[model samples]
Target: MRQTWRWFGPKDLTSIDDITQAGAEGVVSALHHVPNGVVWTKEEIAKRHSEISTRKDGSASGLTWDVVESLPVTEDMKKQKGDWREHIANYKISMRNLADSGIETICYNFMPVLDWTRTDLRWQVAHGGSCMRFDIADFAAFDIHILKRPGAPADFTNAIADEAGRRFEAMSEDDKKQLARNVTMGLPGSTESMSLEDVQAHLNEYGAISRDQLRQHFIHFLEEVVPTAEDLGLRLCCHPDDPPFALLGLPRIMSTAEDYKYILDAVDSPANGMTFCTGSLGARPDNDLPAIVEQFAEKIHFLHLRNVKRDNDDIMGSFYEAEHLGGDTDMVAVIAAVIKEERRRKAAGRKDWQIPMRPDHGQDILDDLGRRAQPGYPTIGRMKGLAELRGVFTALEHGAFGLK
Candidate 1:
């Protein structure tokens, strides 16, 4: 795996110095300042790269910008209606520009309403500090107690509803505000944000759409854009739905193996593929991690390796740090499978054999408090994650490939 770290760009508090010091040799970033549905010019891409390269800690030594965490899908594209043709065209142009600037992999997702869901951004970890996790109870609290979207209480069992109500009643005003911000406050690449009123209005817009309809929209969007990506020599990797399920009446696609099969068959293109986030898919026990890795290895261009602890049939939690050999994920089998795929590509003489992998989310530990960067992206946590993953990969390579 070619180790990479996601950076929010020049304005991000995690500077180039921080990233290099943490030992990431590549940056997974995007032109976040650029609005959705707009073309990203070569000059803008060049300028961003130049700024990153010229930082005080200096250039990305053995590093380069090779993957874009996302390029926002415009509302028109997601709805598969209105002036989406223009938006798709702009997306293609942006891909072309990114390709010209040496980016080969682009990570995106088709989840409607929310990009990723987390009940707590600072969920306390057993070791120390905190990390992100999704609690079903918290989500229930938000739906039936906080946001109070219509018919939400029915989505839960009577017992769950009762528990959620109790939890909601116990929360202070500050607790409610934090829960609201954690759920609706858009992250770095996400262009949309919601006030309570805005969240309601957004939900209202999806009233007529069903899960199947949303899937169709995603397929239509991919059919329009994947060919352009192939032409531009860019691999489009769609991230799985975080938590891997529907929430707050919002439809979810890309939550299962069948979803990936449907998507690849819908477009029938290698350029259209999966990012294979373990933490997302691992939230569901039904997903066989090693099997999925082996099955989709050919189509996977990017990987996010993290683990979650499943409490029960739909109730799960994640470890804050990406422990190379800890948590529920079988790190040995996962890394072995990735190496097998890389060997296959090497035998075929492919240049881009090393898959780009990142420690998806990390524990907010050490002296990382009050950092101004994006939440869940604290430096010390990622540094710890990187160190752990490196040790695992080193041992695996030595044992599996007879290389020390």
Candidate 2:
């Protein structure tokens, strides 16, 4: 696997020097300032490329942007409403621009409304460090009382609904506001924050769209852009829904292995693929992580190798970011599967055999809490994770596990 890091451009607290110092081979970033529907112009892409390659002293950073973490798919495109065709055209144009600049892998998502959700951005862990967490009861509390979406209560089981009510009643006004901000903390790359009204409006637009309808729209999207991607020799990978379940009464399509197989079958092409994120998929108790990797190895183009500590055995429940090797996922088995796939691809004489992977989310530990880098993206935290993952990769590659 090619080691990479997700950089949020110049405005990010984690600087280019930090990435290099951490020993990443390449970068994963995007023109985050660019809006969702706008075309990423050649000039803008060039500027970003220069930013990634050149440093403040005009010296080469000895790194290149390996992958576009995301090229935002707007709500209009997902719903197929309000100038969605134009958005699709702009998406194709962006793909062409990115390809022209030597980028071949793109990661995106089809989750509705918020790109991802977490009820607590800094939940304190037993180790005294903090990490992002998702408490189903807290989320339900926001949905039932704070956002007050219609039929929100019906979406939850009676036990969850009751627990949510208790939590809601216990929260102070400031607590409720913080929870709302945490839930709608904007997309990963963008700076814009969504107000409560903004979230409600987005939910309203999708009120009539069912899981099947939203899925077809996703396929339509793939149909429109996957051909262009194929022509450009670009790999388009869709990220699974975080937590891998429904939220705010919205339908989630890309949450399970079956979900991915369905979409992959729908848009069957080399250009269409999956971004295998262990943390996201592992949130669901039923998902066999290593099995899924083996099943879809050929279709996976990118990897987010973070892990999560699930609160319980339930499919939908709380989970917090766990250490790379300390979570529910069998990191050793997963890496073994990936290595096996790489061997298969090598035997087949494939050029793009190595997948690009990033140490996704890390706990906010050590000086990380003070540096206040992006929530889950701490300097020391991720460096620690990458170091651990590199150790695992080296052990597996050298036949230390007896795979030889």
Candidate 3:
């Protein structure tokens, strides 16, 4: 696996120098200042490339923009309304510009309104460090009581609804506002942030759209852009939903193995692929991570190797970010499956056999607690995770296990 780091452009707390010091070989980033649906001009792409490739001293940083974490799909495009076609054309232009800049792998998501949701940005753990968390009852409180989406109660079981009611009743005004902020905090490196009013308006718009219709819109988008990606020899990977389940009554189409198969088969192109995110999919108790890796080995172009400790046995229950190899998903076996696929591709003489991966998220420990870096993208914590992952990859590749 080729290790990379996610950099949030010039203003990111974690600098490019920090990424290199952490031993990452490449950088994953996007143009957060660019408005959604606006075409990414070649001049802008080059400016980003320049920023990543050089330091303040004008020396080579020895890293290139290896992957685009997101070239965001707009809200209009997801709903297939109001200039969605123009957005599609802009997406194609963005793809071509990125490919011309020599960044071939692109990651994007189709999660409506919200990119990823968390109930708490810094939920303290037993280790005295903080991590991002998704508490089901807290989320329900925000949905049913705070956002007050009509019929939101019908989405959750009676047990959860009652628990949410209790939680809402017990919360302070500050706690209630914090919960709302956490849920709609918006994408980390995007030019957008959503207020409660913005979220409620989005929910109102999606009320008339069904799961099936929303899915068709995603497939339609792939059909439009995948061909352009293929022509430019680029790989377009879709990030699965954060919790891999429905939330706030919004449709979640890219949450399961079956969901990925449906979209990949619909577009039926080499360019159409999956960004295998273990933490996101691992939140679901039913997902078999290793098996999914093996099954979709050929189609997975990028990897987000992190883990989550599910708070309960329920599929949509609360969960928090765990150490890279410490979560419920068997990290050893998952990496083994990935290596096995790499071996197959290597034997077949595929040039892109070594997949690019990043330590998705890490716990806040040590100085990380005070650094106040991006919620999940801490310096020391991620370096520790990357070191642990590298250890595993090294041992497995050296035939430590009997597989070879």
Candidate 4:
């Protein structure tokens, strides 16, 4: 397994120097300033590459832009509306440019309007530490009362609806506004921030689209772009849905293992791949992380190794970002499975075997308290997560448990 860090840009509180200090081997980043569906030029790509590797003093930082967290697929591309064909062509051009720049892995998602939704951006935890949480009641309150999304009431059960109603009734005006803002915060460190009105418009745009139609749209997208990635020896890895379930009546197609199987089989190429995000897939109770890793070992090009503590036993419940080893996932077992897959790949003599794994979000703690960092992305907190993950990896690689 290869270690990487996700850096937003020069504007992020954590700099490339900080990432180097954290002991990460590579950087996962994107050109966030550029608008969606616009072709990323070779000049811009080379500029970001230099920014990742070169220092102010003309020294080498020993880091490269190894993986793109996303090359954003525009709202129009997903909906196939208004210049989507042009957007698809632009996406192809961007992929070719990125490959020419030597970045092999590309991550993207198809979760309609919102990239990732949470009801609380900074829910207080023990010892004054905080992390993001997805409270079902709070989300239902936002959907049923705040955004007033049509058919949202019917989407929730009667008991959930009643609780959401009470939650909405009990909130102050400011609290209601804050809930709306937090839930629709969209992808952090990106250009696509949405408002409550924007949410309504997007939901209206996807009004009658079902799961089948959305999956077909994704397949069509792959049909157009996956071949380009294949010809260029690029890995087009799709990230699973954040919550891995439907929300606000929007169709969620890429949220499950079977969903991935459908897409991989549809394209049947190594270039068409998956970003095995344990935190996102572990949100669903049925998504066994180790088994999924073992089964999809051939196609997983990148890994986001984080865990979440589920509030309920069911799939559709609340969850919070837990410590690296303290959530529903068996961290050691998952790492073991990953190591096993790497060994198998090495035995088979596959060139692209070292999967780039990053220590994803962490709970706020210690000096991370007052930094006001990007919601879940605290400086010391993520360093702590990286340390813990490195410990597990060391134990596994050194044969601490006899597997190695």
The alpha-carbon lDDT assigned to residue 196 of candidate 2 equals 92
- Report backbone clashes per prediction: 0, 0, 0, 0
Superposed on all Cα atoms, model 1 deviates from the true structure by an RMSD in Å of 2.3
Model 1 Cα lDDT, one tens digit per residue, 1-404: 99998888877777888787788888888888888789999999998777666657564455578689898787678876677889999998888989898889999887766777777777777776777777777778988888989999888878778888999999999999888888885554552347888778768878778889988989888888888888888899999988787777888778889889888888888798889898888888788889999989889999997777666655333223345456677877888888889888999887778999998777778777656346667788778888888887887788656432
Q: Write the per-residue lDDT of candidate 3 for residues 107-160, one digit (tens) a residue.
A: 999999988988998999898999999999999999999999889999899999
**Residues 212-249 of candidate 2: C-alpha lDDT, one tens digit per residue:** 99999999999999999999999999999997998888
- CA lDDT, candidate 3, residue 352: 81
lDDT of 4 at 315: 73
Report the candidate with higher TM-score, 2 versus 4: 2
Model 1's number of clashes is 0
* Candidate 4 per-residue lDDT over residues 156-223, each given as its tens digit: 88899999999999999999989988887876465335788888888898997888988999999999
Cα misplacement distance, residue 392 of candidate 1 (Å): 1.4
Better of 2 and 4 by lDDT: 2
Any runs in candidate 3 off by more than 4 Å, and if so which? 188-193, 399-403
Evaluated at residue 251, the lDDT of candidate 4 is 86
